[model samples]
Target: MARYNHPEWHPLFAGYASGPTPLTTGSYGQLLYVTEFDGAPKIISEYFPEILEPAPPMLWSHAQGAEINGIGNPNEVRALTAPTFGEHLDDWNEIKISSS
Candidate 1:
């Protein structure tokens, strides 16, 4: 299992990697739509346990207004309310440019 350094509700600034888990069984294949001030990335993992399924989506929404300026301080990411996808993922802060 991968341990997160910050709270699950906190926004993510950088680093786009799957959490620790087995990829063969698809136990951690849950999808996460992480949105940060920089951009948004969809992370899919198959190693994590099913009990932790809620983390990915929550983390994705929590990273709305999070910004990693130049200094090393994690700021609070604000939440947005739009009417496109769903109520949970309405207003997103960052927009994705590429897939690499």
Candidate 2:
């Protein structure tokens, strides 16, 4: 049996309840499989956090833009409270993709 691996995915199980940590002072992209926001399941969305020093972090800045497949760009919020999301809060798992 061959083991398949998916690189380019740094899975973090920080459900919508506690929510993920905000990038205090940096810019990066994140892809989340959020099962929160409205009681629906498996809501995939992308986030780009751009925060610089000196300026205080703002929720609106964190949710500047998101691209959710199937559901055209929906309004984004800094956080979402969902009971379902609280059920699964796992640790970080880093798996890099490689060309075999």
Candidate 3:
């Protein structure tokens, strides 16, 4: 039985059928990036105290001077903070390119 109104994806959902369904702990990763926001950095951590760690992502600014993977760029690093994005949030458009 299908749950919501995802009739489009319904056909894609196939059953496991006979044998036991194999499962693995989602220790993979799921990062919820909150960029281009004016809220306090601590506020985001406080909201999701359990999951979100303090480690920041490797944003575009890091590619300049910051020692990413123990290597820095020859060009001068741009001045940008987590709260202050180099580009506007609206500038980023959703890219849904599927490999299939």
- Number of clashing pairs per prediction, in order: 9, 2, 0
Ranking by TM-score: 2, 1, 3
Off by over 4 Å in 1: 1-13, 23-59, 63-100
Model 2 / residue 92 / CA error / Å: 18
Query: Of the candidates numbered 1 and 3, which has the greater TM-score value?
Result: 1
TM-score of each: 0.17, 0.21, 0.14
**Candidate 2 positional error at 18, Å:** 13
Per-residue lDDT of 1-100 in model 3, one digit per residue for the tens? 0011222221111110111223312121111211123443211110111223322222322212212232211111111211122221111111101101
Q: Which one wins by lDDT: 2 or 3?
A: 2
Off by over 4 Å in 2: 1-33, 36-40, 53-56, 59-100
Ranking according to lDDT, highest score first:
1, 2, 3
Q: For residue 12, what is the lDDT in candidate 3?
A: 19
Query: How close is each model in CA RMSD to the real structure?
Result: 13.4, 16.4, 21.7
Model 3 ranges off by over 4 Å: 1-51, 56-68, 73-75, 79-82, 85-100
lDDT of 2 by residue, 24-99 (tens): 2122233344433455444344343332322122111234233333322222323233212111211111111111
Worst 10 residues of 3 by lDDT: 91-100
Q: Report lDDT (Cα) of residue 52, candidate 2.
A: 35
Q: Deviation in angstroms for 47 in model 3?
A: 24
Q: What are the per-residue Cα lDDT tens digits for candidate 1 across 1-100? A: 1112245423433332233445323222232324333355434222222443343232332333333232223343332222132321321222221111
TM-score of 2: 0.21
